[model samples]
Target: MRRIAFLLLLAVGASALALSPQEGWDLVAAVESGNQEAYARLVEAYQAGDPEAGAALGVLYLNGVAYPRDLERARRYFEWAQAKGSGWGSWGLAILYANGIGVAQDDQKGFRYARESMERGYPGGKALYAMFLIGGGAGLKQDINEGVKLIQEAAATGDPVALNVAARYLASSDLPGLSRDPKKAREYWERAAARGYFLARGFLAYDFFFGIGGPPDQKRALELARPLVGFEPAATAVWATALYFGQGGLVQNRPEACRLAKDQAKLQAGVATIYGLCILEGVAPGERALGLAYLALAAAWKHPPAQSLLSDWQKRLTPEEVNRAKELLKNLP
Candidate 1:
């Protein structure tokens, strides 16, 4: 059987086996960045029955990095790798089942796979399972305390995903006994960013941009944010804000900021507000109507500032302009 062949080949693939989990992931990232040599080596490893390489291949297919996105192929590679006892394989399956990536969403299956991955000492799996416990999304009892405990346990290992989750929990104020602690969140995010977690970098960049939990470091903020502009929405928001305000050594580019926000903002409330503000203040009289339209979307997203701005804009603009805004809103996606 294929599984038997994998087990047998594992002995011959000591090179791949020697890599730590983080190093395996670093190789995947290299391939994702168009390193053909890395990709060739990974493929060679997989052909030689390296479970970690197989899992990395799954990641490539899952995210369309080196290969076109093919969820079914990803699943197949994951299954093969998991059969060989690769934690990354189980983690991939967990994400697929948890979010309905290629098949019907099955929270129970996701939870089971996440547990398997965690048992294998994968920090992402531990953090993921912790989320399922916290949200009770897997048809099980909710255990916020247990979930928080799990996050802390995983974070102690210094994995970026686990650290990011810990930061999120620290930042959340509505969870029963857990008070908001921006300082702790900032510290965790900084650690996660150092480990190359782009989302965490984005958050820390935002914090630096605005002096949250620390003094503003505009230079550092731009350094952390510019590379992530097209990759993470959080970074997009940071870049948009920075460019609009001419902060972080960036040239003031109100028009470019709004342009950057146009498509990316529809789903990001904060970015929508920035786009709306830019349009309102910088655009022509007629185009200003669309600014209110964008602000209205942000208001619908439950952004308090957006709602306040909407009220002010409605009061300041003429009735005709308000009607135009309404028309613009209807046409926006």
Candidate 2:
């Protein structure tokens, strides 16, 4: 959902200082010291079209250095730099749009901007934009195949998240289109886990415990899960499920499982609010809560459970009600 890194560079010739490489470093020091006059001078240099000055101005605006926070201005400066064909500008603008920081959220805009940066050889932007494409289904149709390819492109450029996802697909036979290859999957997942993608580690635990992709190794599974339990509620739930079932490498630990499940359930309940709201909107076709049909199709696209529930409800609804739902879903994203 966001870009991963920042670069620090400044202009020397435009600053009207002794033109040396260290001049850029000196301007950066001035910014860090909250010297407004020096900061303004640097900004003026940027206005004169020095790429270094532009980059420095972008940093100042982005960090609120020696000035009030102004993400809108930062976004503008980034746009200027990007127009000059700098990767940083494109990367910065993509993040701003993706997270709705300096502009309205526009997933497609963010996706295209990020892709542009990546195409310009920005590795971090490549991974981040690909993530937006995968999660937001922006620009591209919601094709899991294309999403996987974008993710692979990011992984090729060394994005840990891409690696984590690829590893998960290899390990799990659950991914939509990838062939099931246990050994290859194990290799990818294990490599990602070593690099600290804790989710991949947790998935590795599942694989070892279930022996779907490899020989059962409960102890190794627990070893992997231990580091991941606190990272995500879902991960915690998996660990608890393992303990509850006493099937994974862990010895039966029901008390621990019960405690963890209770905690995890609370988090899940909060997420269920989305589903509940969709039902309230009458998008679930047979939503018992709201009789009005506003957007049944949205509910179906959001989840398989909603689709199944809507199908069941449609069987009992009158023809008029069913037709209304069909219309609503057709208009939904």
Candidate 3:
């Protein structure tokens, strides 16, 4: 009787195993290959018990890439996947908590789930865990050496974002016990640039334009900057500098330099924006000059050469007049 009962149980389990790859799992495979119809089909065919499908749908809902943005639904799906022990589920949940997206921001919780996913060998979790460690500082007690090591591991696994960040840290003056090696920095930046990292291109252009630790090569700088055109604000400033100084074989063109500076003023947090905000905050017009504007601001504050300019301007006026001018620009209206 016991043998007969065990045989019957085995038969039922075999029948269930026969349909292991469900229709929803197939839909996930299709979605991964960029099949729009298949993705939609998968979303429609997803069953409550399908963890992979749940994780995919959760990501789509979370990002609002195509489907309606639904945080609650995303959370539900992520939770379901978590219940099913999905690595991606844990990783997504960590991101939501870390970014304060549909949840209270909690780095400790984020780190916990991220570490869980990382331990399971999720490459993105590794990168993200490293970023949280690097960026949180005192909140997370940033350990640059440990962060660099983890980032390098992620970058080696072909995380493009990780590649750029690791390269920057390797080149950064802020990393303790890490001596400056421009060539090493350039090497990592080049690796990232090859994978279409626009920011890496911008930094690489700087090295070429300035001949920093490498032979001056303006042509190479221009080449690096060319593909990154229309995207980088700081790159625009660098390009403007090169144009203004005729450095890296660039022809000096004041008009183009002015145009770039004007364009930069429109950008968020650019040097031009700094001047504009300073003016809007009550600094007078022409009180600040463009094109190396800081030099002029320094001069205005009576900083050495700036002091000489202030004295010259004062010679045309009196101390009372200078005090009156200071009073006029004293506070933001």
Q: Per-residue lDDT of 34-96 in model 3, one digit per residue for the tens?
A: 688976555543452555567667765753434556778888887887677765567778777
Worst 10 residues of 1 by lDDT: 171-180
Q: How much lDDT does candidate 2 score?
A: 0.56
Provide the TM-score for each candidate, comma-separated: 0.68, 0.42, 0.46
Least well predicted 10-residue stretch by lDDT in candidate 3:
16-25
The root-mean-square deviation over C-alpha atoms between each candidate and the true structure, in angstroms, is: 6.0, 13.5, 10.8
What's the distance in Å from true for residue 70, model 1?
Answer: 12
Q: Say which candidate scores most in lDDT.
A: 1
TM-score head-to-head 2 vs 3, winner: 3
Flag regions of model 1 displaced more than 4 Å: 1-17, 22-50, 53-83, 92-116, 138-141, 176-178, 282-315, 318-332
Best-to-worst ranking by TM-score = 1, 3, 2
Model 1 compared with the native: what TM-score? 0.68
Distance from true position, residue 168, model 3, in Å? 1.0
Clashing pairs in 1: none
Cα error, residue 39 of model 2, in Å, equals: 34
